[model samples]
Target: MALTKLVQLENFRKRSGSETSVAKVLSYSYASPLLSSPLLSSPQVFNCTQLDDLLEVYYLSPLYALEFCLGFPGNLLVVIGYVVCLQEWRSINIYLFNLAVSDLLFLCTLPRLSWLYANGQKETSPYACIIRRIISYFLHVNLYSSILFMVWVSVDRFLLIRHPTRNHFLLRPKVAMAVAGLSWLAINIQVAPLIVLMFQDMQKAINSSRCTDFASLSGDTNSFGYSMGLTLTGYVLPFLGLCLSSYNIARLLKVQDAALQRRTTSYKRPLRVVTAAAAMFLVLYSPYHVMRNVRIASRQEWSGMELCTRMYIEGLYILTRPIAFLHSVINPVFYFLMGDQFRELLFAKFRQLLRKTGRQRGAT
Candidate 1:
């Protein structure tokens, strides 16, 4: 009887080990069902089965660092230049100020995310999960809020040019401030659900061995309807509004130029503004949104795509993600280049610095 009991205990241990090994294998195999053939199915063989190569770590970490370096100071300058130096606040400046604030908020998250990528996301505390979720939420908030503010800026420009005297109430600085506040509130509310979803996912992954690995697990839906909804509402509609506003502004400028051919040069600045806004939407944001939708679609179980196709989609996502962040860096540059007052103030400040330096040299 003693021998039989010992044999039973040994058999139980073997079964438990096998089950744990299979569970581990299944976790990876589920990421790409097509690669789950019996020949390469064992957990030992697929121990390093990640959805994509670790190459993204090398690619994304430096890009995040670069973005932080450029975006932080550039955005801060915009905020300071508008708030302190410019005494007369135009309606458009209000939108620009809020946009700068949104960009700065997003920039604040980059160092943490960069460190995670640089060292590998090995911080597995529950607090790490909460922090990651907050970062993700604000990232989206800043993105959508920036886009909406740009839309407001374009429309304000249109109103200023197209019906300068008729819509005084619409172009008031107070109205712009109200719109900016509403945009911030709306975007935060929109992204609040994602925070809850991420927390729930973290609960399920509480026992995950590696914190970095746990954080990598996305709670994003693979549903077609959800992807389409995001694309249409978040991207397509705003893009359409921007285009319409830009087109009308261009048309009005052309009409004005034709009416007063000698005043053609006056229209150039406004035209440049429209062109810059359109180019920003086309170059920086469009690809990111399209690639994001494509990546989501590729993850669907019914897609029937091979592993290579999925890999490509994942790579494209990693590549475009940083490109989207470039918008924050570019925005301040755009404001300085396009705003006459901003440029004037920047030059004045530069001359003041030069004078101050010369005085110190004379004293020395």
Candidate 2:
């Protein structure tokens, strides 16, 4: 067996052995297996790091599986409903359609993640390594793209409601398309450093036994600054956008439509989704954001307690992945259940399916 083969069997295939034992097994291809000493027969410990094992069993594996379970049906309905609305696309629905697509793309990657996490991310195949990295790289871009598009949608809603006089300038579908395309381009630029860092320093990452982006960098100012800067941008920019959009939306809601102000001082659903979304975003993301900055800031003066704090924060961070993704699963509730148009679409689809089945039965 090849070294890579041993790596797979020991990890994924769950065949037991130490490195020496596996090396001996491979040595048969090179020399005589029967000429082995006691070292040759010793069992091989897997290439999977201890952290990988713990994360796989305790968090990463379960979260990957759970996210897929929750995400597939959630995003699928949103995508289908979103697609049906394409003929009459507003800027809001356009962004929504894109959000659905991005979420779907992420869902497509979940199975590979589940498999890798189940096997403790040993990365025995170089192709597997490359594929995983590429998926992650695109996911990195999509993260920013999705957030910006979402914020833009909220901002659009804000402008149309709050400043209707000035907002009509951007209400065109052509303009929305251009903005979305440009947003994606910007995200691609932002994510360039990740690709370079991954490809250039992957060997060092593997050697570090930390299977994450931060582990690959050298102990230099440039590397430190680059890593921290990317992480901060990933968090801070989207957060600011969300904050501004939310504030504007709140302002719009408060204005009471000028006409409705005479009748009532309330909203239909009381802004529950808005509050919940904002709260969950902070809860799920803060630990990861905090840890990323702290990791960079204290690179030189590493504290044992700080390291432990970061590890605990990472635990929080891993837990947060599914929670953050749960946003996709939850978003359609507001889009479909809340919207009159989408509800009508669902009913029409149901009626159409029932009619199709009846027609088939009549033919029989």
Best lDDT among the predictions, by candidate number: 1
Return the TM-score for each candidate structure: 0.80, 0.74
Q: What is the lDDT of residue 249 in candidate 2?
A: 67
Q: Give the per-residue lDDT digits (tens) of candidate 1, residues 66-143.
A: 999999999998888787678788788888888899999999999988888777566667677567767877888887
Best by TM-score: 1
Report the CA-based lDDT of candidate 2 relative to the real structure.
Answer: 0.58
| Reference-based lDDT, each prediction | 0.68, 0.58
Candidate 2: which pairs clash?
A: 17-43, 17-44, 17-45, 18-43, 18-44, 18-45
Off by over 4 Å in 1: 1-53, 164-167, 209-224, 304-308
TM-score for candidate 2, residues paired by index: 0.74
> Candidate 1 has what TM-score?
0.80
Clash count list over all predictions: 1, 6
